[model samples]
Target: MKKVRGIYIKNSAEIALMREANRIVSVVLDALGEAVAPGVPTMRFEEIAQDMCRQFGVQPAFQGYGGFPYALCCSVNEEVVHGFPSRERILREGDVVSFDMGVVYERFYGDSARTFAVGTVSDAARDLLDATRESLHRGIAQAQPGNNLYDVSRAVQEFVEARGYSVVRRFVGHGIGRKLHEKPEVPNFVPSGMAGPVLKPGMVLAIEPMVCAGTCEVEILEDKWTAVTKDRKLSAHFEHTVAVTHEGPVVLSVS
Candidate 1:
């Protein structure tokens, strides 16, 4: 039976498969975490992700999807999500880069991202990363059955703003399953008078928090995919695929 909610709800069996898919994500992230540092080209990380996907027996969900050429979306410093990877974009000491990716295992998809420090970053950058990462956890904690969808959003905004950061409103967390992106349009901030739909068990959501150190305003680059802070200040992003349950929310992606 279909629920009134506009997103697909996974069953226990499907959730297990999704967990497996996200497990590959976790392993790849753990492997790549050690490789993030000064002098490494952004394209090199993309190569690492592609090889890992092949080794793990899964296909990359982003490569060739909507013309995205690489397995990983590498955004450095001021760039937010969907930054194109390139050999020219070399990491420097004190730079932070956000790597985003998705994988398909047994016909199910899992998507996640993390912002990593290149080497020795400034306190401002470190604090931005901390706040963005924590905002993701705060949002995921609200992904419980019977809670309104934007309850998760509200938590993200409150936690981020309280930490003196701004949450990105254009891009948001989303539902992921058979396809990379599913329905219900999970926003990271609670809009005015919006209660949103109620969460239920078996729902899988990719709760990502994109936080900016300055104004929340963002502008797309001429490339049309890279989103950067309009003020050119620092930004950070973190994400996880979570499954809502009677007990609470189960984070499918972990490292």
Candidate 2:
């Protein structure tokens, strides 16, 4: 279903709490990023991330939320997102893993994701990740008051397609605050026709761009959560929780 929500701008005090939550989220990802290497088990990475969240007195936003069992979404290679962590699968050289995590502190939530290449990866895979990351930034640039949601989508779509890539249409970014997901569904690609309503100040959004190396089409695994490219090609994902302000779009989840 199409999601359209009005922006919910938080006050100064609420923004402060949200920043602290995001800071911990950043730390968790930093630890995970550093440990991402050949021979490391994804379950071990999840343990480290969960430990970090507990140390900060925060809760794993994904755990138990809509039946997501783990604290992190561990997607490796062809797996796009929501892959279950398992010790059975060890990280190998040239493999790329995407970690998507969310943390809640003082009642607010912060979510973000990063794709890391284990050891050395092929030029093609590296370029794919770079393009997806850049598309995220391009989408962020349009997140100001008075701009439509499609404006952000157009920026991301244009950049990815120009580079010979396509974005996953099934999942897109959404509003976030005290809850994991709120109003205003943010699409990474243009939604058939014109853009949605103009953006307004105080709206917090999680803008994630998932791009595929081949066709944009995707299929969910039998596991019922992990998504993968239908053509069996590679995909990359990058995300950031941003807030619209009079000053401009502020990326709250940057580490």
Candidate 3:
């Protein structure tokens, strides 16, 4: 593991607490996946997740973080991520919903996201979800200690691009813990000649892959929060808060 300044590396004890926080997120996500179906309003997701967080004695991490109004980002179809949840925004058959949420437990943060199929989705939609989730795993595999930061970026970019899909360049995964956004940002596409910091044993990151079925280009909607695709094609996102260890990369946000 690299000894780097300015980055917080959790010790085994602190990692245990982080795992507790991540477990809460994991269970909450599972419940959300089951509730994700046709005819369910997007705001319902925010309600359920918030209730679950309270039951677990945790706080919604995104509720007021940067003034985000809801407990979750309930983006649908062409919406890549950070879509505002609304009761008017209802889900229907063949629609794919991306549920992104996080929790604050004992002052530690846990984050994770997943895309779900509401009903019988098209072949193209299925492929997008499959590729995006797979890219997340591919990116996580590179989160091992001693690996450079961009290794995870290359893994995601190559996997998605090779499938003829585009990786959203505007948004990348990030380091998460104690505070929501941490230092040493993790990008999905690592540009030429830019190698990021080395992965250390105590380093914990929220590795996510924001993928698009069309161009990787994206635009911020007038809402000033929602991020959507420029080409208006479907997009999918998957994320996990992972930690680096001497043994390997350990996913913190999984129950």
lDDT of 1 by residue, 28-95 (tens): 88878889989998888888999999999999989889987778888999999999989998899999
lDDT of 3 by residue, 1-255 (tens): 123656787888878888999899999999999998899999898999989988999999999888898889989999999998899999999999998989898888999999999999999999999999999999999998999999999999999999999988888788877888887788999878775898989999999999999998999999899998999999999999998999999998887
Better of 1 and 2 by TM-score: 1
lDDT of 1 at 119: 91
Q: Stretches of candidate 1 above 4 Å error?
A: 1-3
Name every residue pair that clashes in candidate 3.
none
Candidate 2, residue 85: Cα displacement in angstroms equals 0.7
- What TM-score would candidate 1 get against the native? 0.97
